[model samples]
Target: MSDFLVVGGGVIGMMTTLQLADAGHSVTLLERGRCGREASWAGGGIVSPLYPWRHSAPVSRLATWSEGFYPELALRLFEETGVDPEYRQKGLLYLRVDDEAQAERWAREVGKPLERVSADFLYAKEPQAAPGFDDALWMPTLGSIRNPRLGQALRCRLEAMPRVTLREGSEVTGFRQSAARVTGVETADGIVEGDHTIVCGGAWAAELLERVWMALPVRPVKGQMILFEAPPGLVNRVVLMDGRYVIPRADGRVLAGSTLEETGFDKTTDAEAKASLRASAIGIVPALAECEVEHHWAGLRPGSPDGVPFIGAVPGLEGLHVNAGHYRNGLVLAPASTHLLVDALLGREPILDPVPYRLEGRVTSRR
Candidate 1:
């Protein structure tokens, strides 16, 4: 069996490790901190893109393929690890409170079945929604997942694999390269050699690539989210308003997020951002104003120049690969990303063209 080393412990890293191990490859996963505690845990867990038609064709295809796998993957992970990821098809309601023309354009461009609903229909559907909000486009295929629980489930299930070695709190300082191929990684403890290495470092990918005088154009975009404890059935479906979203769990927790800021590696939450999110969320659903805020935190998303993830072999490094820069859709695209990476490593046909996300000629130019 081939030996593989994955640097990073977020959802993308964990999922890639799981896929590699299941394919009978000996896998070693190194995490600088606790696994899945970074962007993966901090995400809003929306499975579909904010605007699917606006994204590249490859990105949309990967998301569609990954969404199809969540049903079976969630069930299997829950059964094996005894932790429910809470994958739900509660649908999403994109309210068109202001931009009617933009909403209509999106509906036509996406070609998805969408129904225009009036204010009365919205009130009937979600009694807690605010009064002023009127028209909305309903897309029933969108879904969400409990991100923290998903990470926990993945960690548990991956730990059970005989061929996988998980190293938590292990920081990779650099790599050992011979000509164009990476021989191994140099960690805080010592050098651990592997046949191949995949950098799934999330927001910290560029730091690792810098060791090889190469960089990926991945930047950290900060987002702040708040959690509220409410009664069950408070809100039945995921609701989207402009750029914000309110997601309700099966229990009694409602998650409201988030503000996208171009802050570099800063995970601090801003008071103004929080206040704005609270105001905007309450505007969408007035009941959120009464709910107690249980938790408030922030995380950085790995963003790229073209809003698409870089997934391919790193140039000048034959045995090294990258699957980072997924921005906000890491969890939704994890399965398909892992599948594509595995196939590329094995010289198999990829589900989608690797051209748009390729890393060959642009490695030196990437920031």
Candidate 2:
């Protein structure tokens, strides 16, 4: 069996490594920081992104497949790891922000369950919801999970895998290349040798590949969010409006976020961002304004120009692969990405066509 060296320890890397190890391959995972504490932990944990219909066909394909696969994965992980990721179907209440017609048409075309609600129904469902201009769209099957708990579950399962070695706090400084193929990884301590190397480094993927002259257009797009300690039922559903959302955790915490900025790799949370998010949250669900600010933080999403992830074997580079540039849907897309990558590595007929997500090319994500 071939051994693999996987970079980065976020959800994408960890999940992929876990799948690889289970497939009877020896795997070594390197993490620069504590595993799962980065964007994976900081995320809002929505199983489906706010506006899924706007993404490209490849993206939508992966996302739709993932939506069907997550429940089973979550259940299996919980049984084995004793950590519940709190996957729940709280549904989504998309307050009409942009063109309601566009949202409705997209929903029907994509076959996503979107029900139009009268203002009275909206008021009844979320009484504290800020008085909105009439129209509302509700999706009954959208899901969510506590991202940190999901990360923890994966970490625990990975630690118990027989042939998997996880090196936490070990920073991968560079890769060892031998004429177009990556042979191993160079970490802060020493060189860790492997036959195949996969880079899933979120925002840092492009820079790391640049060291080997392999160009991947992955950059850090910072997103800031605020957490509020509200009553358990303060926000019944994921209330989304104007690119911001308020997600309610099972344990009385509501997360309101996030602002997308091309601010390089800076993951700083300023007062303005906090205020903006909180204001958005209150505007959507007025009751949250009284909730105490629990914490505020930021994360760097691996953003591509078109929001499409590079998810196949790198062209001209034998034995090298990547699964990054997920932007806002890393958690939602992790399971499907793993299946897609494991198939590519094991040389099995992939469950779906892999051409659209090939390593090369920039595909537009939104129309």
Candidate 3:
């Protein structure tokens, strides 16, 4: 069995470790801080892309393939770790959608369930939604997961695996290389040797690649979110409108997010963002105005071109791979991304074409 070093412990890294370990490979997951406390923990966990048609075909393919795994994966995690990811297919409603015709055509092409609902039907499904909205595009098959819980569950499962080693608070400072081939990585503690090293360091992936004299397109795009402890049914399904979303949990917690700021690596929450998000949340569901804000936080998404992640071998470098740059859709796309990474590493036929994710053409010129 191969020894693999997975750098980063977000959903992507953890999922990769799980897949590799399941395949009888030994995995060491190294995290700079607590696993899942970054974007993966902070995300709203909409299992599907906010607007599936708006994303590229590669992004859609990964998300669609990953969608099939959540129900079973969630149950398995719960059964194995007793932490319910709270994966649910409650559906997503795109209120005030920009183009119904385009959405319908894309839905038809994808063969995913899509329905145009009048305001009456929309209100019936989400009674708390604000009034005066003419209609919405509903994708009933879409769903969400509580990502923080998901992270907890994954951590628990990984810790239970005999072949998996989780190094929390262990930062990968650089690579251990043999000529053009990466042998492993250099941690603060010392050298950690492995047969293969995969950089899944989320927003910091670009920095890691830079250490190897390589360039990557991944950058840290800051996003902020606000939460409310409203009633369980306050926001029934995942609601998206004008690029904002409100995701409801099983319990009495509701999350409304987010702002896509190009601020580099700045995760500090702003009062302005909180106020704006609060306004947006109350605008969508007026009853939310009655609920006090429970939490306001920010996370750095590993932003890439068109929100498509890089998920293959770093060209010109052997024994090195990467699976980051899944901005916004990381949680939804985790299963497929990890599976494809493992498939490529093990020389197995991939479930999806990996061409779109290669870093050769996508990486920016050296900074």
Candidate 4:
């Protein structure tokens, strides 16, 4: 069995480790902090892209494939770990507050079924929605999952696997590299040897590679989101207005997010950002104005130059791989990415082309 070291214990890292371990590979996961507490836990948990048509073909393919795997994964995790990930198919309503013609054009190009409804129909479907909002594109297949619950479930499941070893609060400082391969990682404690090392560090990926005089073009795009507690059934569907979105959970909480900021590694929630999100949410759903704000937080998404995530092996580093720079679609793309990583590592044919996700453009010259 191949010995594998997975750096970063976010959803992508954890999912990859699980896939590899299930394939009979000895897997060890190292997390700098609590597993899955970073972007994976802090996300809005929307299981689909904001605009599926706007994304590139590769991203759309990966998302579609990954979304198909979530239901099975959720069920398995709940059965094995007894923690529900709350995977729901509550459909998404993307309101076209402005730019009706643009929305129509996109709908035609996307080939996805989008029904144009009047203001009355929208209110009849969701009475809590604001009065002024009218037309929208309804996508019945779009859905969401509870991110924190998924993380917890994955951790619990991993703990039950004897082949999987989780090292929490262990920071990997650098790597031990030869002429063409990374043999092991240099951590705060000491060198940890492994056959393969996959860096899934999310926003912190670039910093980890910098210790070896290598740099990834990835940057942390800070997103601030707010949560409000409403009565159950207040909002039944996920709604998106312009660039903002409001996701309702099975519980009484409605998560309204998020402002994408280019700030580096600063996860501090801005009061103004929260206020802006609250205003936007209220504008879409007036009933939310009466809801109590429950929580507000920020996360650093690993933003790439292009919108697509970086996957597959890092060039010139034979045993090193990267599965980060997923931006806001990390959770949505986790399943397919895990599959691709495993297939590539095992010398099997990948479902998608691995060229676009290669680290050529992102990584600087390797030592």
lDDT of each: 0.86, 0.85, 0.91, 0.86
Residue-level lDDT of model 4, residues 287-313, one tens digit each, is 999988999999999998777888888
Which pairs clash in the backbone of model 3?
none
List, residue by residue over 113-147, the lDDT tens digit for candidate 2.
88888889887877777885586888889999889
Global lDDT of model 1: 0.86
Which pairs clash inside model 4? none
Find the candidate with the highest TM-score and give its number.
3
Cα lDDT tens digits, model 3, 38-119, are: 9999899999888888888999999999998999999999999999999989889887877778889988998999999898
**Residue pairs with backbone overlap in model 2:** none
What TM-score, to 2 decimals, does candidate 3 have? 0.97
lDDT of 1 by residue, 238-339 (tens): 888877889989896988999899979889887788888888788778888888888889999998887688998887678898999998889889989888
Best by lDDT: 3
Selected candidate, larger TM-score, 3 vs 4:
3
Better of 1 and 3 by lDDT: 3
Off by over 4 Å in 4: 97-111
Which model, 2 or 3, shows the larger TM-score? 3
